[model samples]
Target: MKMSDKKEILNSDKAPEPVGLYPHARRVGNLLFLSGVGPRKRGSKEIPGVTLDHLGNIAAYDIEAQCHSVFENVRHVLEASGSSWDKLVDVTVFLTNMQDDFKTYNEVYARYFKDNQPCRTTVEVNALPTPIAIELKCIAVVDG
Candidate 1:
């Protein structure tokens, strides 16, 4: 395939830097694929609403705060990729404690997604790469 056919990596200065080598998002044709985004903000390691114990373990976390931050992060990525929240087609959410956090997460999710309802699948996971309790993987369409 030609080099032009390869995916274009996208990043957002308004969003948090990824913990790994990957860019915040990638564009393949008219579709924008976003990497997993957590609650951490740009230029900071502190997870929003997360309280750590003396041993650096997660002592407490606010799912609501994480949800809002993660959603805004997704928006930044989408916009940086030449897309928007209404352009999102699908989203996959990862939660470390589904049973305890789902309700609050869903409520916060409703506030942002009420108008632009995208296909979503939420699942419980043992852990994330970081101490964050929630993360979002999203895909959206870019206009030609």
Candidate 2:
């Protein structure tokens, strides 16, 4: 592919920095692919709804709060790429305790996507890069 056709990184000061080397999202053609977004706030170590021990182990958490933050962060990345929640086509959700958290997470998710609901998949994972209980990775279709 031509260099101009290569993917472009997307970043937003309103969103938390990536936990690793990857960008917040990448644009390839008309699609924007977002990285996993956690509940940690921008420029801070705070993870909403999560209480961490001295050693950074999760002591307790509120799935509703974390879910809100994660979805808002995803929105920031999407807007940074000139897209919006309505443009989202698919989303992959990761939960540390799916059996216990799915109901609450789904409730919050429904509030956000009341009209433009996208295809979604929720999976249970042992853990994430941070102590937060939830993360979201999404894909959006953007107009040229």
Q: Number of clashing residue pairs in every model?
A: 0, 0
Query: Global lDDT for candidate 1?
Result: 0.92
**Candidate 2 residue lDDT tens string, 1-144:** 864486888898999988789999899988899989998999999999988888888889999999999988998999988999999999999999988999999899999999998999999999898888999989999887
The candidate that achieves the highest lDDT relative to the unseen native structure: 1
Model 2 TM-score relative to the real fold: 0.94
TM-score of each: 0.95, 0.94
C-alpha lDDT (0 to 100) for residue 91 of candidate 1: 94
Q: List model 1 lDDT by residue over 1-144, tens digit each.
A: 664476899999989988889999999888889999998989988889899999989999999999998998898888888999999999999999999999999999998999999999999999999899999999899887
